[model samples]
Target chain A: MKQFLHSGFVRLAIVVVMAYVIVSLCGLREHVSILSGVDESGTMHLVFGLIYILSYAASLVLAPALFLAAIIETTLSKVNVLSRKGQEGRRLGCSELRERQRLRAPEHAP
Target chain B: MKSRLCISAIALILAIAIWLPLLHLFFRPDIGDLGLEKGVSRIADQLAAHHLQIWTNPDLRNRELAQMRQLNPEWDFMSRTFLVMALASIALRDESRIPQCLETIDLVIENTLLIEQEDGFQDFLLGYGYADNWKVQPPKSIFVDGEISLMIGARRMVADRADYQHLMAERIGNMVAQMTLSPVLSAESYPDECWVFCNTIALAAIRLGDVLDHSNHSEFLREWVETAKLHLVEPQSGLLISAYAVDGTPLPNGPGPEGTSIWMACHMLQVVDGAFAQDQYQRAKAQLGRSLLGFGYSREWPRAFAGVMDIDSGPIVPFVEASASASGLALLGAAGFSDKKYLRQLMTSLNIAGFPTRKNGTLCYQASNPVGDAVLLYALVQGPLWEKAK
Candidate 1:
């Protein structure tokens, strides 16, 4: 579980979900003047804009980043495991072949 | 560590690449549903339904008007005019709903005239009009007279009311006498200040008056149009100057196509000169219309014209130059011309940005005041009245 959580893919999916919730809770879409860099009260509605912008950034930007990171990391880890297993199998095969050879040589020499 | 960092960097780039282009999809509305099919569009029906509720519910109507009155009392009067016209258009389109729409229309017209009678014409005049003797000695405002006349004309077009006809004729008589006497052939909406918007509406009222009363004003309407074409146009834009003095001199703002004035004027202009009106619509659309990220809006002035922010323009958004006021009126222009693409885009923008609030089956936009809502409602239901008048 710790290893799973440590995976970049899992962490990014969590960030995307959290951001979606935050944006929904904040009611950022209702403050559309933030798109124009203004608020309903006619001043700069910066905080709302920032929250929405960040949420968007996370969804499109950070979340995607995390997903890609996760995919790459998972792919790399799987490759590493497969390659290690292959090496171990080869080493075991070599040892088994030498043992068989020694047993055969003893029979022939006697 | 370096390999991990490199992976993270690539992921970040990939995420940005994936998300930026897809963002608009999140905001994309079902545009096909809003297309003009059957007699009206879906958004138009929703807007009309919302307005029907307001006209029936006194508390809601008053609550909406009170906010507008606080900002500018003129909106209180204008909102009534737009609502009455909207109801007329809806009544004509949907015969089954006529009885209910007429009830609200009558209530609006009756109450509006009553306010004008009790409060006097000055009651509707804005602060600038009331300032230090801009009005003639009799203190009549063409703005008040023009809008009220059009309201009465619209009401009669739906179903004639004898009392409204009498009142309309009386107002028309006064306007004709005034227009005949003025050297520039224009009437003042304020003290010595004439607006193209008011003049076009007043002219439309006269045209409707001729239709309902079997009177002739074709010659007069023609003469006024010629005069406007010759003198009222801004040299650069070829659009009529928004406001002018009694002697045909343009206001300081020059011949700019103001968002608030252009669409509504083009609407009334259809009654005066259909060809000229279409010309103005195309020009105004070219000058003011803007689209961004599939959302459409309008600007207060054309790119060639520079102006400051005012109540009519609302706050101008920089870079894109989106004006809330212009965008609202753009609906009228788009609907009038049946520019389905622009209309669809504007409506989508409205859904995304207009801050619509729906409750108990009634709807309103929180971002807009009563007048803005009325203008939008007018856009949705305005077709029938113009067709009937024509």
Candidate 2:
């Protein structure tokens, strides 16, 4: 049932997360040039040159939420009743096949 | 079923740990932007008040100094600088606190000048600095002179009193003339030695020049930094040399993002040139600022530069050169840039490891060098002076 979480929404969520991180980090380069000045107090302030901090910040807020939603979907899908039944069936069938193999094996009583 | 339950439990814990800090990041804090304030930020306020106790109470100050002296004398000098810078900010933030902040500043200015006069300025340096003569016949140390002048200069800039302005003009004139006489745009601080600290001081002096109407000095300050970029600063790290001779010669050192130092350098350069200041801060931030399990840690140097640890870096622990100087100074840089997230992480780290011991209603971080605390104070009280100057 967890496999059901591998759906379109989950994929889209992951892609959004990656894209958000990429663009947010890329935007900081411009800030590098702006902050390199001697301040009035004569002290230097070093920011990572993330002039568009709000944008990286926006991504920082959104990307993780999307990823969390994907994880929840994956978890919820793993808990379905039919999926549980299907797993039970597979476990029983495998057990029975093993028992039959044990019974059918022609071995001298060593 | 049991295995799945255990796995899920572990995953849930990890996820919560990861998301909690990021979650805090979402909520825009309604508080002030971390300038000097009264009771608004208990954290920054407490930090300043603790340093205040040193000047206000001689007994407490002596006890603290006695303990720190066993470590390094540089720390002792740094404590004065940091506290002076912090009080200057506090004065700006709380007008009511001016009388108190000014008292501390006055005492510090007096003591600093007294120390310089008594020790001949070289007393604060490492023994090696005194060894062998500097190549230039008339030895000089712009580093000592520059910072001392700036400290006094900043105090006066915030709340002008007649005493400080006169001293600043004298220091500013001397620094400007020294730059002009040297053809390479480099002044000999110690014989022929040039240092980033001194150069930054000159920049600060020039900035004060602009504020005080020292018009003729601008061109000299501008040209010196340009020539300096060619002679002292490395093209690779974009960080300046740890030390250099007069003629741009590398003295066994290439480049170091030396711990704590890089952050201080960034903060200092912020005074020298805005464009250069911006570049230094961003470079240091990218190279050092890191996050692990949602916690931030800053390194001493970037990958491009390799260096051995020393008194300045202050003990790089394994796997990462977490130079106390660089990381502590990074706090100033991060705060200066207004990178709230990094600042938050750094503050959190300070709270966790900096060993805050609240004594007599004042807050100070234990395990931090005096210089480290000074840098922190400068970070806290930085904005108003800059804004006021403009």
Best by DockQ: 1
Off by over 4 Å in 2: A1-110, B1-33, B36-40, B180-184, B187-192, B213-215
Which residue window of length 10 is worst by lDDT in model 2 chain A?
A: A36-45
In candidate 2, what are the lDDT values of residues B219-295, reduced to their tens digit?
66577668767766666767766556666565454244454655666666665667877887777777778755444
> Which tens-of-lDDT digit does each residue in B1-390 have in candidate 1?
776566556656665566556544555556544434335556556766787776678897777666566667877888788888877877787788788878888888788788888977877777776665654556678889988999889889988988888899999999988877666678888877788888888999999999999989999999998998888887788888787888887777434558778888888889899999999989988888988766789988889988778766778889999998889888888888888888877887777667676766556675676677788878876777887778
DockQ score, prediction 2: 0.04
Residue B88, candidate 2: Cα error in Å is 1.3
Worst 10-residue lDDT window, candidate 1 chain B: B32-41
After superposing candidate 1 on the true structure, give the runs of residues whose Cα lies further than 4 Å from its correct spot: A1-110, B1-35, B253-255
Residue pairs of candidate 1 with colliding backbone atoms? A9-A70, B134-B191, B135-B191
* Model 2 interface CAPRI class: incorrect
Maximum-TM-score candidate: 1
Query: Model 2: what TM-score?
Result: 0.71
Q: Is the docking of candidate 1 incorrect, acceptable, medium or high quality?
A: incorrect
- Ten consecutive residues with minimal summed lDDT in candidate 1 chain A? A33-42
